[model samples]
Target: MRPDELDTALNNLAAEHRLRQRAILHSPQGPHVRIDGRDYLAFASNDYLGLANHPALKTAMQQAIDDWGVGSGASALVAGHFAIQQQAETALAAFTGCEAALLFGSGYAANLGVISSLLGRGDAVFADKLNHASLNDGCLLSRATFRRFRHNDVAHLEQLLRDTPAKTRLIAVDAVYSMDGDEAPLAALLQLAERYDAWLYLDDAHGFGVLGEGRGVLFDHALHHPRVIYMATLGKAAGVAGAFVAASHSVVNWLINSARTYIFTTAHPPAQAAAVLASLQLIKDEGWRRLQLQRHISRRHLQSGVGGCQPAFGLAVLAWRVCR
Candidate 1:
């Protein structure tokens, strides 16, 4: 495209109030923040447990930096995967009750790598209509026949599953829908996956570290099946900087071998992984953060006067639904 064409597109976005811009953060992320030298009551972060600026995490990160410099310096397959990363992965697997876990640079990369590596041209992927964009992009990249059912409609999903003739079928959904903040029908979806012999992939990015007292939706609902693959992000509620996918040992082994995103990208700084280890311990031991999150949810509901009708829980990331 021509430079003028790009300029015109940007101008259109600005006119539509849809232009995206980055805010320069002058302070650590928390409930309140200073952006571009101006202080504001910030409710925009996904740091559900208010641990982003926790002193313990900071100390751990600093200690890690002291022990193991700043960068991983190479791709994970090329000697960048450090001891901290391995420890974090093991802890994540144990925390989620999965047989194994694989870490990725970010939630986006994790989703893309997992989906693309698992499903291919002859396979079929069924996704919730409201899943994150990364999931959808991954499906598209897989060269699979992608079908999206109505948001959280298990019946629609079953219909799609029943009709798909592909030998390999995969179902992808967000455990907690990010935009609407509603939980997915994981139990029902799992039942469908069992009946149809399809793989179930749950992206618990928003639910992890806040729900199930920090173990996430899978643990909360006892949805641990061999066919299920669980994914959670550390940058959000875990107060760290990476994502991990947990599943059966074979699944994780397959990802380690075949996921191009994991194979090619440099591992996240070892310091970040060290901090995540400390964050995980804090998440398991300090239950007050979860309690505080519930209080915030309750207070917001009461203040908004949406009595009895609890707004879908995004925990710290509350979005009010107003009726016109």
Candidate 2:
């Protein structure tokens, strides 16, 4: 099809959702931002800790730029991997309690690379109904037999696992449902994974840096066994950009060598990686941020004057939907 035709088709889908509101940001993301050529209250950003424009993070980035000269210049395998990236990856692994962590350009790339590399046509993949589009697209790209289980329903997941008879079974779930603002039953899901000898992939995009003392929903459940693979995005509560997969050393090496996204794509900027490192330290050392976030969410829950609806539970990536 013509490029204009495809653009028109995409526009039609956007119009269907009543999501055509376009706002321009003049400053870095935060609770209060310069939007649409004016300052406004912004609750839509993933900067739950309000650290994107933090002085420390900015200093770290500037220092990295001064030392590293900016761009990575090539893929990680071809000399793009620097000490900054290594430091950030190591910090992420320690934060997530994993033996090793592999960095990717974004959360979508991390999901796609991990899911597709580990599963193929002969595998049976079960995913949460409310999983992010990245997980769904990863399943499709993997050529696996994709099955959707009820969102956060352990019983439905068990039934699906019992029904599928593939040589390899993989279960994918979101630590926190993004749009619905709900959490997955991680303990139960991990139990099922252990019983069925399946690999459990948990995307903690909304939970990391805000849930379970900044460890995430899955970590809160203490599912640190080898069967669980944890994925998280730095762009969220970390107030930076990039994604990572924390798993066993074997899996990390496999992704490093075989995951197309990691192998083929240019490495993330070293400055960004340095900024992420600073953000990681803030998330770990400054426990008050997480506490404040919880209190904010609680305040929304107790608020009865503005809107009768309370904020969603188990996550703090978004504001409560208050319609006036």
lDDT of each: 0.88, 0.84
lDDT of 2 by residue, 156-246 (tens): 8999999888979899998877775667888888889989989999999988888778877656878798888999998878888989999
Q: Total clashes, candidate 2?
A: 0
| Minimal lDDT window, size 10, model 2 | 315-324
Over 184-213, each residue of candidate 1 has an lDDT whose tens digit, in order, gives: 889999999999999999999989998888
TM-scores of the models, in the order given: 0.95, 0.91
CA lDDT, candidate 1, residue 76? 88
Please report how far candidate 1 places residue 103 from its true position, in Å. 0.8
Q: Report clash pairs, candidate 2.
A: none
Residue 16 of candidate 2: its Cα lDDT?
91
Candidate 2: C-alpha RMSD to true structure equals 3.3
